[model samples]
Target: MMTKWERLAHELRLKEYTHLIVGPGASFAYLTGMTAHVSERLTLFGMNADGHAALLLPKLEASGVPRSLQIHVYTYSDELGPVEALKAFASDLGVHQDSRVGIESGHMRIFEEHALRQVGITHLVSADEVPMALRLIKDSHEVALLQSAAQIVDAALTSTLPLLKVGMTELEVAAELEYQMRKLGSEGTPFGTIVGSGPRGALPHGGPTTKQIEQGELVVLDYGALIAGYAADTTRTIAFGEPSIEARKVYDVVLLAQETAVDGVVAGITAEDVDELARTVITEAGYGDYFTHRTGHGLGLDVHEYPSIMKGNPLVLTPGMVFTIEPGIYLPERFGVRIEDDIVITEDSAQVLTQFTKDLLIVGD
Candidate 1:
């Protein structure tokens, strides 16, 4: 099997790209296999088809690079500018005056691009599809990391629910869950923990707030953990007490939608088809308009990656592809219910990575 960098070099050669630039993000981590804190600083790694690569970092960050990779390391001090360092690294990589460099358009900074332009490299194009395709399929090792991360969050959620109280704020619950995730061995969280309760649950991405949890309301806990650079995302909606008839009905519909979608995960299925399956369930439940957002999204190095599970997407599912199956129903001013699970496609069917029981939980009884 070709190494990730070697495969990237092959892509560069095939695309006739003279160089490939990656900045800090999942794309950077995917290519380099080394995690670097993302900042405004001009740290970067440049690669070419000739198997030549160069690393330019702030002097203090130079030591973080692995000693095994034989790439040229160019360090810049606070006194010396990053522009000169970029020039030196560009020369080391043999990026010519007219080199057609490829960059991750989403993550590359304008200053970084200007540095390349100043260093005599001319043409630059987006190589966004390269990493998107390369990282879409998870290898066994990647799967294991995702599975371990999912297990940690599942265990944490299982242990944290019993601690919920009626008067606690949404932020408090989020903090406690994060604490449990960390205690269960997660290196970090994939994103800001969301603990939307009561009417706020209608907001799809409503982050945790200081609003107190009240009785007879639904709380949506949307969060995930990151381990070994891979991520696991899941959402579970629970009631603080006996919710209204409408709330319980919506919860049942969302749960059914989530389960149906998860069951439809198999190799060769179109992403849109999986999405429609869930959407159909919600529509038949008389909450079609309430089912906002895509049914799910791919989860990996970053929380949201390629292969979005939504209507009109043509991407076909395949073994090793993993994503979330979160179907939600949000009735404004009433409540919202979203049940999510991480799903991995197999040779014949799908493997649900998240082990949390999706059955509705009634807390603070």
Candidate 2:
């Protein structure tokens, strides 16, 4: 764990800004080692260039700030109004009318930005871009946490397989999977559990519904777990019984596409190049339109982060950067096949984090 002062100094050097403004996301947690519930009220962390930091919070939440931060805390009463409180705190903290401040634009609401400007912070720059660049490279401890989260997800999926027999509703399957993940010590799922069967399976972001599973249908299971503030994502397509030739063909093609994309993931390669490897395979299989959405996305404190694998992204792969490589072909009004795996770029090659079997599993009766 990095010290608050150390992290603040690092950000100042990397972005060449005098101060860092943190919000209520992983960035805040990473910088201060504090996790406070997000609310309409603004929670800001201002770290100056001198390695000194201050926290601005509501009076109600002032007590919630961790004792380890060892920084000055300014609190505003709800009755006093947030803007007035913010202005007073900024004045007390010596924020001048022309200080070069770095703000997280992604998390800062327009109203909040306006309030900051009202407080004489005119030379504000976006801190999100540079901070995200720093976050893209994970340390060994972060990798271990992600690996543990992946193991928990694998165990949950493995335990839920027996409950996926014929006649089970898609919603029921999803509920069972979530329950198993919680039982296996996962805090919660990173995203909604996808338990699409038959035609619903064709929808990439389909949620579990009341549709019942039947024989000779395809089922797509895409789920993940949040463990220790880290996230893991994986997907696998299985057959309820003996799948039709068309379904089998599509599955094989999608599997091949995913493998090709994974093969293309190596250190120094661009994210777009990796995506093209999968896109080319699916397009050659004559399912170009069916393959909607990007090839993959980065996963960590947030389910989605930087270094997206898509057609236009030019981020270069590097060791310690983790992401998902999910390739799918969705046939309208029929079914869809998706194979996803979590991969972390290493020095030599890509390391697959999820250890579950990718071979199509066929359940019967």
Candidate 3:
């Protein structure tokens, strides 16, 4: 079992920091097994070079700290201003003028950084890059949790498919999908559900609208489910009736492109190379300009994280790293098609996490 102290030690080495300061993200959760309800009151996990760790939080939230943390906990009453209390707490923890602190730049507020400075701590550095690099390679426990999340998303999409039909508004279908995901034990949708019918499908991030699904129109459903802080992203394009020849051609290109991209993912391959494989396929099909957005992005605690699959991202792929492979082709004011699946890289090959059928499904009178 990985103890909090052990996790902290790993982070210290990964970040090459004398001390670590964490906020309310996976880094904090992974190390302490506690969720910080970040707000006006600052919550932090601080660890020194010698592996000694401590937590500082608002007095009211102290009870929520897990017993497994096995670290010194300091809290400040609401009566005392949080900043003042934090300063005193830092003093007690021996954080002084010469302390080198690592802070999460992505989640740490500007004022909080200023406060740390006022308290006599100098040499603060961004710790996000280090943790992000570490998180790219998932441990066995994280992979198991991610697989479970993918299954939940797969079931939710399957159950919601039967509700699709001509005349149903895109917003209605989106609502039904959300309801199914919740009923299937997903904590919530990883992001806003996207339901695009016909021309709206061309917009990758198109939010659900009141436009009704028409016969022969291609509908794009892009969504994911959040389970225990992990996320799964998938997309499927289905038609209410027989698709036009043009739609089918575009869909086929996207499917082929996505397959090529997934095949490119392997241990030691650069993330950019994986994206190029898909882009090359789409370009050869004469739809390169139509296919926008990166091939994929790393997924875990946040829907989007490090090691993005885009041109120029030189991060090398490694076993246990998970991300999405989505290739899309859109025609303005006409229609679009996309096929996406989550993939986790292995020593020899990539494992597809999302198992929902990508085959074009036609449903209508």
Candidate 4:
């Protein structure tokens, strides 16, 4: 079997790319097995089809880089900018204005691009496909890590749910949940823990706020945990005390949508099919206009990856693929309902990794 670097080189050759540059981010970490701090200081890993590989980073990080990589290293200092280091690395690899350089478009900042241009490295194109192609499938070890992460999140939320009270602030609930995750062996949160209560739940991506939880309100708790490098994202909506009739109705719709979406997950189905399963349910229930955002997104080393479960996505599902099944209904200036769960696609069926009960939960004192 060819190594990861060998596979990357083969891809570069196939695409006729002169060099593939990855930033000090997830792709870099995924490929090199070394996680570097992302800061203002420039850090990059450049490789070509000919098998030559090099890392250009700050002097402070030089010692930490593993010699096991057997790649050329170029270091820069704070007194001098990163352009000279980039130039030296680019020069050795014969990168120039005409070179077909590929970059991680989502991660590499504009300043990094400017620095690349300064070093005579132009003709940069989006290289998202190269890395994502390899990352889309989950291997055995990766699946194990993801399963562990899901367990951590499930346990944390279960523990935190009972502690919630009617008067507790959203921030307090978020903090307690995170604390429980830590106690259960999570290194950190993959994303900000969301505790949107009442009308605040209308914001799908809302983070925790100081607003106190009130009786008869809906609280949307969207959170995730990072175990090792894998992530597990899930959401659960709970009632503070006695939820309004409208809130209960919305929650049932969202729950049915989510369950239907998860049940539809099978090998060979397109991502769009999975999305439609949930969308059709919500749309038929008359909350179609309020059902904002995609049905779900891929989950792995990064919280969001390729093969998003949304409309018009023709990506086919296969065994070992993992993603979230989150369908939501958010009413403007009113409460919202979202139910999410992580699932892994198997040969015959999709396994729901998050074991938490999806019953319309009523929490808080």
Pitting candidate 2 against candidate 3, the one with the higher TM-score is: 3
lDDT of candidate 2 over 1-365, digit per residue (tens): 76446766776876788777776778777766777557778787777776777777888887787776677887888777677767766765567867778888877777667768777778888888756866788888889889988998899888988777888899998999899989988989878999889999999999998988999999999999987788999999999989999999999999999999998889999999999999999999899999999999998888888879999998889999999999999998899999999999999999999989988898855
- For candidate 4, the clash count comes to 0
| Number of clashing pairs per prediction, in order | 0, 0, 0, 0
The TM-score, computed over Cα atoms with residue i paired to residue i, of candidate 3 is 0.92
Whole-model lDDT per candidate: 0.88, 0.85, 0.83, 0.89
What would the per-residue lDDT of candidate 1 be over residues 1-365, giving only the tens digit for each residue?
A: 98888888888888888888787788888877778777768878889888788888899987788777777888888887788888888888888867888898987888777877787777889988777878999999999999999999899998898999898999999999999999999998999998989999998899999999999889999999989989999999998988888788788889888888888788999999999999999999899999889998999998998789999899999999999989998878867889999999989899999989988889987
| Tens digits of per-residue lDDT for model 3, 1-365 | 65556665676676677787777777787777787766777777787767777788888888898775687887888777667766756765567667667888888887677767776777788877656755777877888878888898789878877777799999999999889988988888878999988999999999999999999999989988887778888899999999899899888899889888887778899999999999999999999899889998888887887769999999888898899889899898999888889899888989999998878888764
TM per candidate: 0.97, 0.91, 0.92, 0.96
The best-first sequence of candidates by lDDT reads 4, 1, 2, 3
> RMSD per prediction, one decimal?
1.3, 2.4, 2.2, 1.4
Per-residue lDDT, model 1, residue 91, is: 86
- Candidate numbers, best TM-score first, in rank order: 1, 4, 3, 2
Question: Between candidates 1 and 3, which one is better according to lDDT?
Answer: 1
For model 3, what is the C-alpha lDDT against the true structure?
0.83
| Pairs that collide, model 1 | none
Model 4 regions more than 4 Å off: none
Model 4 lDDT at residue 269: 97
**After TM-score superposition, what is the CA distance of residue 166 in candidate 2 from its true location, in Å?**
2.0
